[model samples]
Each structure stands twice: as structure tokens, then as C-alpha cells.
Target: MRVRIKGDVLCTLLLVISLSTLLYSLLRPTAKQDIAPVKNTKRLKNPPRTAASKKYYDSKVTGKVKLLSEDHHADVDSEDVKPTVPPVKTQSPFDFQQYLSSKDHRNFSLLINQPNKCTKPSGESFLLIAVKSIVEDFDRRESVRKTWGKEGLVNGVRVRRVFLLGIPKNKTTVSLWESLMQQESHYYKDILLWDFLDTFFNLTLKEIHFLSWAEMFCNDVKFIFKGDADVFVNVENLIHFLQNQNASEDLFVGDIINHAKPIRSKKSKYYIPETMYGLGIYPAYAGGGGFLMSGVTMTKLAEACKEVELFPIDDVFLGMCLQRINLKPVLHEGFKTFGITRPSAAPHLQTFDPCFYKDLMVVHSLKAAEIWLMWNLLHSQQPPCSQKQRIKKPFHWKKKKTKQAINAVTRLQVN
Candidate 1:
């Protein structure tokens, strides 16, 4: 009985211990706690704070923002920014108002009345005397045409119309042309006009007047004598010289300078900028001191003037026009252009002294009175006006035979 009780107690004790352990486990688990997942430890290993990762991020951001270049990504501070160029404006095709409003039209009537002030006359006519001024050193024309005009021959070719050119500043007086017109009208054919100022000729205001006359009276005239007033032209000789040459449509004349810059001096009356004209060299006949283009050339030049902007200097402007047409200037030595200082002694002198009237065809820069005197000197035996003043002597009667002899002598002298 004692052994049985001891075994039972041991069994009871084992049961109680098992029960207590079970109850403790069940009660404790009733208060539940949740646990989160473990973070990526590999991400921490390659930290975003590192320089390589930061640079990669920056590059990726830049690539993604490229489309925002217009607003934010443009290089505004760059020195190589292209400049904005303005479009070129074309001129109106035909602006008559512009013609009337141009600086040239300011004194049209005044200029017409004073043509010789800036221009010269063309061929001599029954009622007109052509005139010009030939400035050789400044003009750069040949000195051989003086003889050609007088000898009535040029390079085995004869030309019609007188092409007188070049007159220095001193030779041009205000009323000289009018005075010449009035005095020589009896002998000429018609006075076609030309001048340095003929914007076509690149002349001054006074010279333009001369050139305008040709344009003005082109309808009323035929043929031209574009010569210098300063020159001593033998009208008869010039008429004879040009009679044989065939009338040519392309009578491009003068000692043509190939390329020349139109002058643009601020102080000068003639000023032109490069933007105004595109051509660098004159393609047309230049050196107006003594050149002869056809009346058609004048027409073409006038037409071209409408299309081309006026260059302050005339010859170069004309050359530009001629170049456009692909025509060239024909160099003629017979169109005596400039200086022959000692023409009397020099070979092929284009200009000579008034005293050398017999040999001189065109002596540029002469006075009206001097021209008249020289003409008289060439054609007549005595001077027109005595250089010295002589007091009149009291008249005295002489014997009839002696008077008759004196009268005969006086008549011979007068004739």
C-alpha cells in the first residue's frame, strides 16, 4: 500500500508540472507583437551619398531635362551666340517721286539755266557751240587725240563729233558757256551739252549742268561734241576727223580704269558708301575728260541711273552699269584726255599752248576771250583786240595818191 501511494504522488506531481508549463505558454502568447521585414542591407552597402552615385544621378537628370532647353537649358552666357541678321530691303522698281524728291532735283530749272556751270556742250551746230574742259594730269586721258582731231585721223579711223574734255577749276567761269553760245552761234550746227557734273560723267554741280543739257536736248539734237571748254578745239578739224568713221552703237570711249572705288569723303560734295553700289571697278567708259559714246549710251546711262543708286563720282558709276551689260570701254588715244605739258616739244602731245593754235586741236583750260583771240589768230592775220591801249592820233589830210596807197595798205591789212 505504501509503495502504491508513493508512485501515485510522483505521477500527480509530474502532471501538475506539465499543466503549469502549458498554462504559462498559452497566457503569454495571448499578448501578440508583429515584426517588420528586414531592410535591404545590399542598398546600404552601395550608398547613394557616394560621389560616383551622385554624378550618375546628375547625368541622368541632365539627360531627362534636355527637352527644356528652350526655357532653362540654353547657354545664354555664351560668347559665340549668332547675331540676328536683318533682311535686306529691296528698292522700289520705279519711283518717279523719288526721282523728283532726290537731291539732284532740288534746283532743276536753276541747273538748266546754268548748264555750263556744271556741264558742257556737245557737237557744234549752226546755232550752237559745244564746249568742255580737259584736265589731263587729273583726268588720266591720253595726249595724242589733239593731233588726231586736227589731222582728221585716229588709228587709221576717223570719228565724228568732237569729244573735248578736262578743264581745270580756273578755266570754268559762271557765264562762259552762255557767252560762248551767244558769240559762236553763227558758225555751229547745234549745241549738244555735257559737263563734269553729269552724274553720268561724275562732274561737279557746274559740270552736271553741262551733262544735263545733253539729256535735256537729246530729242532736239543729233550727234554730240563732248569736249572740254578749257581745250582749244578746231571745230572744222573735229568735223572733218569724225566724218569717216562708221556710226557705232558701242562707242565706249576714254582711257578706261578697270576697277575704281567711288569716292566717299565726308567733306567732299561727292560721297558714296560701299553699300550704295555693289561694283568695285567701273565697267563702263570712264575718264570723261575726252570720251565719246553714242547718244544711245546717254540713253542707256539714263536708264541705268534709274536702276542704279547714284554714285557721287560719275565715271565709276557709269562703269558699273557697263559692266552689268558685259560691254567694255574702248581706249582711244585720239580722245585726248589730260596733260601734255610741253605739247609743242613732246611726242604725241594731246594739249598745247594757245599760241600753238596751228598744231593744237584741244588746249584745255582757256579763257573765252582767249579762245576768241586764238580763233581769230588762227583764221585772221591780226589780233582781235590790241593787248596794249593806243591813244588815237589827230586826223590829218594827205595827198590823194598817198591817201589811196595808205587806203590800199589798210584794206590789205583788214582783209
Candidate 2:
């Protein structure tokens, strides 16, 4: 009985040892797989720079992609989509010098392969260059011209050149360009052009102004006014302002916005970029409110322009160029840059009158009729009866004060 029991115990121990050995062998592989040793591997080989090779690896993958399309393509089509021929990238054709010499200097030359079809104007020549855009309405243009045009010779002052530029339009903006050119072409002979060609090449409009001014100079233009078309420049007043103010190379006369910073807002038409004009004090330059630049100043400006890079914005760019050469922009009090509300200062004689033409230099953003009226007021042989007013005030201060003084003297004498 004891022998049989011992044999039974040995058999049980052998069976348990065999089972444990089998379990260890199965679990050992799983443990090894779970905790496998890491190894560093070499990177894949790179393809060549050519487009064909680039398709294989660089720009595109020419290899087949497994598709599970509901409507499977043919086996051949599914194989791979390869390029027939590779495209090539080339250099741009922009000649800076030739572009500068072109009659129309505004707009980018790099993008547009074609030249301006318009001819270089000649005979009975005067160049009136408008920096901004001309409005579509011919009436507006004619109205301004009638007022500003030289009446034979206004008090011995001559209107030599008149060029109007509409806002900038590029090749992409062809429609705008066509319309603008058409509007001016009908009436104006010497239509001057300007664009991003200077700015793209990093050249200033001052250079264009310089070149145009040089071409015309004293022979054509007696006084050159550089301003926005939107501005209603009292041409007669502007001429007087230039002549009476002793216009010279060092002198620049205009309505000045005095601040380190221009009024910039997203909604405002005067929105300037932070990149172009960073936050800081800006030196006061003449506002776009019709600045009267002397022929002498134009020459100086033209000469100064050769050295400076083109800045995008005209007025500030002009200011910067002037600042570089130590030319200061003179603020004319007669110039009403930002228009007045009737509530502001009453129109004093010699000071600007919101009512009558009390030495009004330039009024900007005027409608056609308003421009006509202003012009008529300035030129008409008849004196205007009374100043137009939104609100009529009693007691004319200038006359009433004189009468009061006389009355005081009489009363004192009687007493």
C-alpha cells in the first residue's frame, strides 16, 4: 500500500512539472515580443531634381495607389498616372529702364507684356498728370477744366499741361483701365500715366514726376500742381499762392496735416498699411489737398528723385523725399485741407470763409456744380451778393461794430 502511494505522488509531481514547462515556453515568446529591443535604421534613398524623377518622389508620386472605387478603372489606368512632359519655371521679363521711359509709368511691367498703346503726346504740349484716378463722369472733368483752365493767361499765369490719372488698375483690372483711359482720351491730349512699375522696381513716383517735369520744365508748365483730382484746387488762388509766396526749390506749399501719424482706419478712404507706414510720428507733408509746386521745385524734385527708391503712397513719399533733402513742406493757412462745418469759426476777411471765397486756397472733394459755383465766384465780373449759408445769423459783426462805435461817440457828445 505504501509503495503504491509513493509511486502515485512521484507521477503527480512529474505531470505538474511537465505542465509548468509547457506554459513557460508559450508565455516566454509573448513577453519577448512585447519587450523587443529597438534598432536604428538607415533612411530611404532620395530621388533626382528633374521633373520626371520629381514625379516619382520629389514633387509628385508616380507610383500606383490602391483604389477601392465602386466603379473600378481598367487595370492599365489603375496602374499609374504619369506625366507626358514636365513643366519648366522661367525668369520674368521686366526691363526697369525701358519701363521708366514709357509714357505711362504707373502699373506693373513685370506682369503685363504689352506696352501702353497711347502715343507720346506732342504739339501744343502741356502735361497735367493726375496721381489718383479720374471719375467716369465727363461733366466732372469738364467742370474742373472750365474753372481751372487758363483763360488766355490768367493775370499773366499760364496753364501749360493737364494730365489726369484715375486710380491704379493692373492687368487683372483691365476693365477699369480701359474705362479710365477711354474717359480721358476723348478730351485730354496729354494724358500722363503712372503705376506700380516704379514701385515694383522700388522706384518712387517722384522720379516719374521729376522726369515728366524735366521734359516739360519752364517751356511748357509755368506752375505745376501735384495733387489728387478729388481736390477742388482754386487754380487762380493756387497760382497767386505760388507767385505771391515766392515759390522756389526749397519751398513746398500745401495744406498740411500736422501729426506724427495720419488718420488711418479700415473704413476710412485714407487707410494706410502698417507695413508701409508703421506706427510712429510722420513728418508733415503737404496733404493731397491741391499743392502748388513751382516749376523750380519740380526741377529740384526731379533731380532729387534719381537717388531715392519708390515708395507706394505719393503724398507721404513726397514728404519723405523732401525730408531727406532738408526740404520742408510749408503749411498755407489759406488752404482749407479738411472742409469746414458751418458751426466752426465764422468767415473772417483774409481768413478762410466757409460762406464766401474769403481767400480760399483749395477745397477738396467738391461735386461738379460746387466746383462750377466756386469757379464762377472767383472769375465772374459781378461780385457775389451775399455768402451762402446753411444758417443765417443776424448782426454782421464787421459792420455792426463800426456802427456801434459811431453811436457811442454821438451819445457821449450829446450827454
Candidate 3:
């Protein structure tokens, strides 16, 4: 009975011990569970201490959030953090040198040429005057044709006049201009048309092309006068000047400028950058407004043009050509490129005088009205004004009237 009682006590003791151990385990918390809640609460209460810390926190949290919210806005803040894009590059408009130096532009084919316009096998033509004109300048062309450009004899030398023209810019205008040119050619047989653009910069092209034409057709011509359409040429005085010159000697005559510098200002219409010409001083060359060259000099200049690179400025480029051939231009006092400055006298007091322009070979910048008036005045047989003060009066005369008077005088003398 005592042994059975002891066994019951032992079993009771073992059951109490097992129950205590089970209670302890149920009351104690695990390490991960205890720290997880504390960490989340701390993060919610305190902001990040620095940009680096904030970035780290945002990277960790936003990575998961981005993946979950991709359908709605994955890249909402991404653009703000992205790097800036670079700007596009642009081309320069003043790079004319590169355009000029291009190999494709080295040679140009003639669009229109008059091979037989000035040709004379027996060499009867004493002077061949080439007037650089545009296709659309019909009024100016007509004025020239009627005034100084009339085809006839000047001082007993047979003179021929031809107008130089180039292609128009507009395609529609091209056909119209071409048709008109064809009719003009048929009627006057004086228009020399070419295929290049007739621009201020392309005046050198006109010069070179005319030189080529002269070589082909007018080889035997004694003198060649290259002038602008607006100029008044005294063919009589020009012939008289040529009469004194040796026909075999090369002659290049005009109002010459020496040591002319290339215009560097970008704002100027005559701007020429160093890329076109690098020289500090330009050799002497005649103003392009009007110039005179003998047949031999024209041949030499034409040959020189072939070897020298083309310059945009016609006068400067001609100077370069002359430099290449070791030739120089003769300066004439009477070749007025700038229009004759009017004296400070009353218009009524200023009577038109024919003697004033009788000695001048070329007078530039004349209008059609002035040219006509001058032509009429020169033809009229009025006695010379005997005003003693007239000799002392500033030699001021209207351009058109002066040209007309000079041309009329030329006609009278030649007849």
C-alpha cells in the first residue's frame, strides 16, 4: 500500500514539471517577431537624416512599389532624376569659302553662246563693245541701244555693239526671258545670252565667258570695250584714244584703284572674307563700271583667268588675272566710275554743256531720260555758249544728257 502511494506522488511531480515548461514556452516572444514591429514604427516616426540615406531608403522601398504600381505610374518621378539631353548643332551661313572651293564648282558650262555674233574674217571690225546687261532690264537695254550702243562707225572705225545676258532665276521667267531674248536677237542681232545666273557676284563669270567668246569670234578685233549697261561710252573719244595706241601692244585702260583692300565687314555688301582672298593689298585694277582692253590684252586676260581661281568680286578678280599675266591697267583721268558730282548751283542756272563730256570716254550711272536728253542736245547745231563765266563754272552736267550729247558728237564726227 505504501509503494503504491509513492508511485502516485512521482507521477504527480512529473506532470507538474511538464506543465511548467509548456507555460514558459507559450509566454516567451521570438527575436524576429519582437524586432520587426519596432523597426516599422521607428521608420514611420523619423525622417531620413541625409540625401544619401533618403535615396537609400527610397531605393529599397520604391523598388518594390514600382513593380507593384507599374500599370498606373512606374516612371512618375523617373524623368526628374534623368540626365538632360544635348542640343542639336547648326550650320553656318558665312561659309562661302567652302562652297567656292568645292571641286564640283570648278568648271561651268555655257548655257548660251554666240559664236558668230562678232566674227569677221577680213577684220573690218575696229571696236567690239560688250555691255553687261540682265535679261529683265528691257528698258535699260533699249536705252543703251538707242543712245551710245547704236551700231555704226565711230571716228571712221566700224563699231559693233553687243549686250551680254545671263539666265534668269525663276523657271517661269526663264521661258519668257528666253523667248524675249530670242526675239531681241532676231531683231537686233546684238544679245549674247549665257546659261549662268546673272548676279553681282557672278560678274566675273560674265567677264570670263565674254573673253572666251571674243577669243573665238572677235580674234581680229583691234579693241574691246567692256562696260555696264548703265554707263555712257564716248565711242568717238575712245576711238581717238585707240588711234594713238599701237594695235600690237597689250592695253588695259580704266579708272584704276591701287592697293585696294578686301572688305572684311560682314554688314557690307562688298564683304570679302580671307577665305576668298588672303592678300593685304590688291594689285591695281580698273573699276568694273567700264574698262578698255585691246584684243591682245583680252587674249592674255582670258588665258590668265583659266589658270587663276575665280574671285567673287569682278574687279578684284580681274586684278588677280592681270597679276598672273604680269600686266597692269593704265589709269585714265576721264573714266568716271562714281557719277559726276553736281555743283552747288541752281538747276535753272546750270545750262547743259556738250564740251564738258567731249573728252571723257566713259561716264557711269546714267538714266534713260538723261541719256536721251544728252543725245538730243549733242545732235542740235547750237553755237557754243560765249559766257566767260561758263569756263569757270563747275563742269556739272546730267548723265543722260551728257551721254546723248557725246554720242551725237560721235555720230557727227564719224559721218
Whole-model Cα lDDT of every candidate shown, in order: 0.44, 0.51, 0.74
lDDT of 2 by residue, 1-415 (tens): 9999999999999999999999999999988655532211111122124443333343332223222222332442421322212344432233334534662443332221112211232332222333333434456656656666433345554354444443343455355765556556555543544444323233344335434434443334435665544556665566666566544344577787667575455433344546545767676777765676655667666656555545544666677767777778788776666764343244433223334453566667767777777667656665443444533553254434588889999999999
Evaluate candidate 3 by giving its C-alpha RMSD to the native, one decimal: 21.1
| Backbone clash total, candidate 2 | 18
Predict model 2's lDDT versus the native. Answer: 0.51
Lowest-scoring 10 consecutive residues by lDDT in candidate 1?
A: 32-41
Candidate 3 lDDT over residue span 1-415, tens digit each: 9999999999999999999998878766676567756765664466434554445445532112222233333443543223221332433324575547652353457555556665533337788889899888888888888887777766677888788887876667556777777888878888887777777777778888888878877888888999888887777788888999987898999999998888787645677777667888888888888998889998998889899887777898899899999987899988987766556554544323565566678888888777777766555576244345645655355544578888999999999
Give me the displacement of residue 32 in model 1, in angstroms.
Answer: 99
Candidate 1 residue-wise lDDT, 153-207, digit = tens: 2333323332223223455543465445434322332223333333322343333
Q: Give the runs in model 2 whose Cα sits over 4 Å from its true position.
A: 1-132, 135-137, 166-187, 195-220, 245-249, 262-279, 343-355, 385-415
For each candidate in turn, the TM-score is: 0.40, 0.53, 0.67
Number of the top candidate by TM-score? 3
